[model samples]
Target: MAAAAPAGDDAVAVDVAGVVKSFPGVEALKGIDARILRGRLTGLVGPDGAGKTTLMRLMAGLMAPDAGTIRLAGVDVSHDRDRVAPSIGYMPQRFGLYEDLSVIENLRLYARLRGIAPRRAQPVFERLLGFTRLGPFTSRLAGRLSGGMKQKLGLACALMGTPGVLLLDEPGVGVDPVSRQDLWRMVEALTGEGMAVVWSTAYLDEAERCETVLLLNEGRLEYDGPPAGLTARLHDRSFRLAGPRRDRRQVLSEALGLPGVSDGVIQGDAVRLVLREGGTPDLLAPFAAETGARVEAVTPRFEDAFIDLLGGGPGGTSRLAERMDPVRLETEVTVSCRHLTRRFGTFTATEDVSFEVSRGEIFGLLGPNGAGKSTTFKMLCGLLRPSAGAAEVAGLDLRRATSEAKRQLGYMAQKFSLYGLLSVRQNLEFSAGVYGLEGRVRRARVEEMIETFQLGRHLTGAPGDLPLGYRQRLALACALMHRPPVLFLDEPTSGVDPITRREFWTHINGLVRKGVTVMVTTHFMDEAEYCDRVALMYRSKLIALDTPDALKARVVTRDLPEPTMEDAFIGLIEAHDADREAGA
Candidate 1:
């Protein structure tokens, strides 16, 4: 592999021309062409099955395109990938390191693979540890590290020999804002040193950080240039539509259905809106009178531009939610945790965490990874017994009546937790029977789920064979087969494209409208805004609990008048650290 660009080649580090990749039943990429130069960060973003991963793999020299050619550092990758392997650093989406090894061990192992001598690697190890702030955790097992720590360690490994080109695939998928910031800092620093980095991310905000962007959709290049060009299209078209905080869902639903509207979502107590061409506040006049809909123009974002570039937003209406029956409960309290604690040996995973969710409420549990949120979720879902205190679901005791309590809720895991070998129809049937549906009832429910989730065509295939969106649909269908009153979603939309996430939330919001209580654990700070109330966990304990707007308000100051959810999150954590330092 060539370390530097060829003479008079415009410093193009990666030259991709007319690239095409196809599967048995699908074409992942079609005639894609892009030039990524040295010392620049390029963002690759697209929808599910939109050829994002395929394009990334092709760019990394891991796969040869069915047609066209890719040149890495003046070398044709298809002709000689091995010749260029030493010049490229690629961090894949899954398991980039050994979980059983320690942080330092992973780095050393990669150093060995890259043939860096032990004495020379020592200084590199120290520098990377300082850069990633992982110096103190070098001896910690990779599996014991938090989500953010693991990503930072993976990035450190990828930079072992200081490769001239780097490809990161969804590195921040399930990482928290704090950790994501760290990862971005490292990538930006590398780019400053003349590294050409291609970052593929689901987070549109992250995409906007790149100097150039290659937007793909349906196997075609939709846009290729500065992200600002796309955002400029949305100038003066974004706004904040506010009413009663309690009516946020209803207001957003109505606003999304109005004519001349392009997009609408609940942000804090208001609906962040984007209007169609020639549309104005005048278009919102219909609902202004009754709901006192206040409108204030706001700056548009990269996500707005991305949505516009692809298509208009997925409408607020949900077909699947329309078919569900309203949940009926005698008590107001749907889920309750009182002084709940969990421990393994002497390590406390969760300590004295207490929260209550009411009927029809969307309760969000959020924190940095390893903050005990997962442990709390497991306790509430009846997967783990709390070392102390009480847990309840639909007024049934989760601690004592684990089976009965489990029957009251539908649990959808972050990984979609489907049986890999089982066909879609088989999985649905198994779920139906497990939930106690029988004979005609079981068959009828399975068929209804298939129709509602649009899984009929994919019935014969395993869930993994489907695209990410369809896999999510199947998982949700399996969870909701029995029509439980409560839903437990663990990062249900993590790593999914914006459109699929909007569709998922539409169904969730619709379910709440029909009286279904939801308890969700999410890494997405923006999604946390959708909750009626949120519980923020830290250091195995509850730190803050409030409405989204209230949480943001606590961090509001003269310098930060309009703070986002991520701002509030990072600000709150910093304040907590400051307070602890002062106390110490």
Candidate 2:
């Protein structure tokens, strides 16, 4: 219905009708249809494998639809993508970046390719560098930048040609809260200047900020309109419950299973469920009592409503930690480094970095895109050797006792690395064997892990067939097959729903209670609060180290409304940028 029209806007910038794309054995986009109005930021929201990326690639003319048409500024993009290429900028989920080249070098190359004269490009590049507050790091290799900075740099490069339409696919996935704010601010500024943006993300919060949102689930457009309209769907029909926290997922599941219940999803400590028309609490009372939950009426948020619409409500919460305590334990340092150095040619990926992660504690390493967090993590995990200095994990130097040190760690990288051909049980069994767990012990652990992670029903299915959240949980289960003393998670909860993120943490927290130390790297500031301690790194240096609240209190700024971890993070980084800028 023409997307119900935004509050007050008429100009249309992107028009796609009956778009359908298919691969060798996959229907990527099933007759997809959507639009982006002029001067407005439209969000393409979907879960992974929901055709969001495919649609974006089609719109950008990087891929063609089997049956449909796409137009940019009313000109057919599918037919004349080259002619309209100069007026469109498309940034894929994984934008190609050179590790060896400096930040400014990459910008210059893009400008030249876009036909910008040296003198003209110079001014624009300078302005972009300043806008992103990355001027001082111009000479730094792109590989050495932090995750947040890398995203910003990517954005800078995308805007080099001043495209009229910008298509960004999950640009803020692994970005910190402060950087996300900066990104949204930049988008707002561009839209104000009449640029149209089609931003895709798995984060509902980011989608809520868009002028209009297109909700995609399983290759179908579920909702395409304003966020207010989406929220309005629930109205008084939504309800919430908060009492003693008691396994909200389980409670919600049972509540929904009742005759009068329709849908439910857990939100933090509460379970927000929908009731049948004219349904009353008495209908749900027995279900709540049986599920060990105290029911109450609570307002549903956008996330809860979306989950309901998608029919992806929370299932029963497994009693994974029933025998174990839920509280995190504080123990002695399990991993320590002193003056650790790693270099590639003349560039230092990790320069004289030093830190210690306590045993049984959740320690978070926070940084921008290439702030050396991954380098340090690889060193500790014995994947890479340090160029100099000492690096010890589990009381043994990784370089000297790599095998022994590895036995003490269970590592989950940025993406779940599992064979798509293998079933969930097979993957777990393989991991168990690799970790030296064998015989009955191996079989028992594998079974336990699957049960704990709720893979029983999907055990026979290939790992690739599982949902993103399930895949993540399976990876975690595989990592813990050998019951390592320490777990190293690299962006464990990236690109997942907030509810799923919380569920993942619930399991991770369970591990902490069993004297298992967790050293994690993440871009989410809210996740930082869950950490026992946090370290903010920049340019291979540890700048801030403390509990989340303590770090928030340390960095003060007048312009920021609330002094959050995000505010402190940005203020600290900005000040460092200013100092370096002046020095440069």
Candidate 3:
């Protein structure tokens, strides 16, 4: 097999041909071929467990391909990594940043490691600091920087020696949208300077911005073309349906059930739907009339095409019970925070934050990285003590009756928190037992969860060995084993693909229908639209709270187009900052 030709006259920075890589029980890549070029951005994209990482490692010369050749700057990297090392800069998803070192110190250290003289390194440092907009923070400890800043610093270090090819793996996963735009600007600038960039991301929107894309799934290359070509496949097959605000979920549920509707998700106050082949607009007319929903033809996005390529629609019946066992609606507020304030010495993580979540509501907490959203979530979950103010979970004070409050909720941390070494079954059993289940009860609960989450096949497999989507399923299963009324999810779908994210949210919607209360934190603005109401936090203060539609409306002005959730979020933050500055 031969690698594809580079676009136009641009030189190929890395050429991969018939690359195959296998782990113990899986073939991560099978006969993969791609030609990444200088002066261009090649998007390496796919769903979870699509072998993107394996291919990246192989290209980076960090791992040997089972079979095939990888050429870096025309040099055989597999056989001569040392020769190719200086020409390639690989930044893994989790960049190795020394927490104790200052930004400039880390850059200088990388320069020294690359055998660059101090005189040569000084100019590189100055250039990187200016490029990354980190000059003011050069003296700050790497650990103290925000998620976006850290990513910039990591990129700066990777470019210390001005490598010809840069491979960045999901650098925008947890960063806010504003910072994400900045990162992309920096990468685009690098490409302008004749450096080739291969960015591996699950974000379809981000992928669409690339010059060319390599779409892989289950170790096989699915599509190798420009993003416009990919999206063009689904032309005129997408539509947006808008109705009464309260009918949003109903609209989504009904749209998914439509015979022609391939896939549907709540986008702001409307439901965006993709139609199956041979499906027509008339097919949706009946539902539209019944629900008072107006349908309009819309342009298909990159996500719509990606989901279509990955087998048009969702699968299997929802595992949740058809109906929720009735809970007494004696109290309206399921979760409440009163003047929640948390301080670490002289720094206030969160200040005077207050909110109330009614029963059966999906409340979203939105903020940029390090905006103190996590601190508020921890306080509400009783994981951290608040310096002042009060919080109650399910009517129980988190500070006072912590145990009682805990029993009323389930929590899924931002990162994978289950024991990686434990088997899927073991983790479920452990969670059940922790919630006080014993003997036959624990066994029954674990089995039920296994069946519910479709984990029977991987029951004996270690959690770490499963795909990211499956790992998420296992984590959710563990969190819900005891069936707590209130659930707290911290960045549940951070790095997952659109398909897996939709699936995860499907289960959450099912649980919500079953009368569960959910509080979630996420950087994905689209996910915020699914919430009944969202609270925007900035600088440790609550800046905006409203339904998604209302929030967007608030942000719309002469300067901005009709706002998406991301625009609304940025608008709210900027407004708050402006107000604070004016007061100061």
- Runs of candidate 3 with Cα error greater than 4 angstroms are 1-10, 244-246, 315-317, 321-324
Q: Per-residue lDDT tens digits of candidate 2, residues 215-281?
A: 8876778888988788776666666565534544345545655666656544434566776556677
Over 4 Å off, model 2:
1-10, 116-120, 235-300, 316-363, 367-402, 415-430, 439-477, 497-503, 509-517, 529-584
Model 3 agreement with the true structure over 1-584: per-residue lDDT tens digits? 11233566348788899999999878889899889888889999998889999888888999999899999867889899999898888899889999999988899899999899987878788888999999999899999999999999989888877888889998888898878988999998888878889999988888989999999999899999999999998887899887744467666876798778888888877888999877888988888888778889988888888888887656323565343464444577999999999999999999999999998899999998888998999999999999999999888888789999898898998878999778888898889989999999788888887877678989898998887778888888888878888999998988888888887888787777777899999999889989999998888888888999999998888988678888888888888889889999
For each candidate in turn, give its C-alpha RMSD to the true structure in angstroms: 2.1, 6.3, 3.0
Tell me the TM-score of model 1: 0.96
TM-score of each: 0.96, 0.74, 0.95
Q: What is the lDDT of residue 44 in candidate 1?
A: 92
Backbone Cα, N, C clashes tallied per candidate: 0, 11, 0
- Give candidate 2's TM-score: 0.74
Task: Count backbone overlaps in model 1.
Answer: 0
RMSD of model 3 against the true structure: 3.0
Question: Alpha carbon lDDT of residue 33, candidate 2?
Answer: 76
Query: Candidate 1's residue-wise lDDT over 221-245, tens digit each?
Result: 9999999988998888888877743
